[model samples]
Target: FHDFLSVLLCGHKIQAKLSSNDKKLLPFLASYLCAVAPEFKPFITFTEDTLKNFDAVIATGSNNTATYFDHYFSKYPHIIRKNRNAVAIITGKETPKQMQSLADDVYRYFGLGCRNVSKIYIPQQYNLDHFFNGMYAWKQVINNHKYINNYDYNKAVYLMSDIKLFDNEFMLLKEDTGYSSPISVVFYERYKDINDVKAQLEDQKQNIQCIVSLEDVPFGVAQTPALSDYADGVDTIDFLIKL
Candidate 1:
């Protein structure tokens, strides 16, 4: 939103209509925006009614809300975001420090961020010890009551379903093909070849946010995206300029 505002301000005067499911967040966010750009204060609003009259919209919402945005804003120029997950490529050759960094990337924000590493692709016959040891750095997350509840619940459900999992006393790792994993859990899948994993990920690019690897995003920095690192790989500034 800030980037869009910056680009839009380069030309015409702007009126920003803001609406959030968390009503309390709007006031704080609006105030912060005003602090950053005082000129935005008068032009900003908290009403959804004004949104319909906007010439263009850039919306980020939940899967259900995105569907609504797609239909309701179809008449206008818009950018609507859907759900996306991040995955890590585990080659089993990472140094102890890199392994720790990968763990930090996954457990940061308690694995709630869209860019958090929720799944991993590892080579066949890879040792799990390296991953588990690295994850020990975030064992404190298991002490958070909300996080622990989800952890225990997910552990019981997986056990009851007879699903195989790697238990680390804090985080659970299971072999699965899905991208999004539950809180306190991460999904992993073994690959016979790196090329195959890359090919598969390419086919699912639309559903993926970032590919964390020694080569791609580097470990422990998924949440700290550079200005050029646009979400869903779409260049927002460029898109806004094109508009």
Candidate 2:
């Protein structure tokens, strides 16, 4: 990490967005990096105005936020923007053990991270009982969280409001024709044929990060991502250097 910072500070200034809620962590993180390599001390800024003066820009945010960022940084010479997304994949021969392992990918961090599994495209004849049985353990932990409770309440209110919206409180609602982040809603079309599933996955290739399943599809991993993974088709160092 210190070596990377040394490379970044060679001729570049670092402008970062620090959430108001996370102000405390920022100083500690910055100080730690500087301790390892004192050269990084002069390159840090924590304001948006400072961000605009940079040679390039990088922004991490939800899909909604990424849209706004594109509009805001349109005139910049270079930019990298990340949007919200999650992983899902089709599998036909998953065993009980595999199903349990996949459940960790689904429920970890309460389905918040982009690497988390938000959807599963299983076959039409797939045994949902074993899948749900593996996931049953997470129900209590999910119920205990206050935000999930609020999400459940908000979904219920929307359902009863007579508004024209899809509402499936028992499972997450999926009608946006895109990904949903930080929630447990999955949207998938069941397929009888593997070729059809392959075609659908190919069509959504640009939108996906990781595809986890029992089948050994090309470039598919079982779960999670490595540190070297380039998110949203953008290189991390290339983003920073342009700025």
Candidate 3:
């Protein structure tokens, strides 16, 4: 549902490939078109074998599925996407409003979309109190059943294994090296050098959708992707034009 919602919100920016692990979305998409598609408008194709007919293809899925698409679509012109995430870098100088806005980037869409900020880079010795002050505004997310359920599940698993986590009922923060976080959880890493962190991020550029910072895409704007903001930094227009 999150994937479909993301497609509905941002798919028009480029030719989107809506991938489902199962073919469950077929009926749903078809039903939606039947209900809302206007009579004068042309119909979009609905097909079981989507890959065979298209001249070129764009596929989105998990890291493992990406490898499968690469092998199968190598002969054809295609784009195969792997999992990616957005992250924020904190300098501890941000105002309460800035942190509040950052909370929106973290909590909006329940943090399921790729553009959602799932990790944070903060300076050493940064005060957690200030960061929590900003994040506190979004505490109401715990009231959501789905979000709370995920929170409980992840928290239980971690606690059973004796893992340490910094949490405030609704959100969990863990010091980790990974870029991706599980639902209802966010990873955090402390950084001493901005340039060093930038270099590190560049090393793993393919796994990142975007960087959220005061200097880059501002807080609360991750969901509002622009025409040029192609996922994984692939220029879809250039790729299409060349094809």
- Per-residue lDDT of candidate 2, residues 42-142 (tens digit): 87665645455565556666668778878888787544446435555556566666666766777676666666767666577765676676565556654
| Weakest 10 consecutive residues of candidate 1 by summed lDDT | 12-21
Best candidate according to TM-score: 1
lDDT of 3 by residue, 1-243 (tens): 332333334332222344454456655665675578543123344355543455566778889989998998888887778899999988888888999999998988889888999999999989988878888999999999988999999999999998999998889998889988988899999989888888988898888888988888898899888766777888766666565
Model 3 error, position 100 (Å): 0.8
TM-score of each: 0.89, 0.74, 0.83
Model 3 weakest lDDT span, ten residues long: 7-16
Stretches off by above 4 angstroms in model 3 are: 1-17, 20-43, 48-50
Q: Which ten residues in a row have the lowest lDDT in candidate 2?
A: 215-224
Local accuracy of candidate 1 as per-residue lDDT tens digits, 108-209: 888877899999998899999999988988888888999999999999999999999999999999999898899999999999999999999999998899
What global local distance difference test value does model 1 have? 0.83
- How large an RMSD does model 1 have? 2.5
- Deviation in angstroms for 156 in model 1? 0.9
The segments of candidate 1 whose C-alpha lies over 4 angstroms from its true place after superposition are 1-30, 48-50
Give the candidate number with the greatest lDDT: 1
Candidate 3 has an lDDT of 0.79
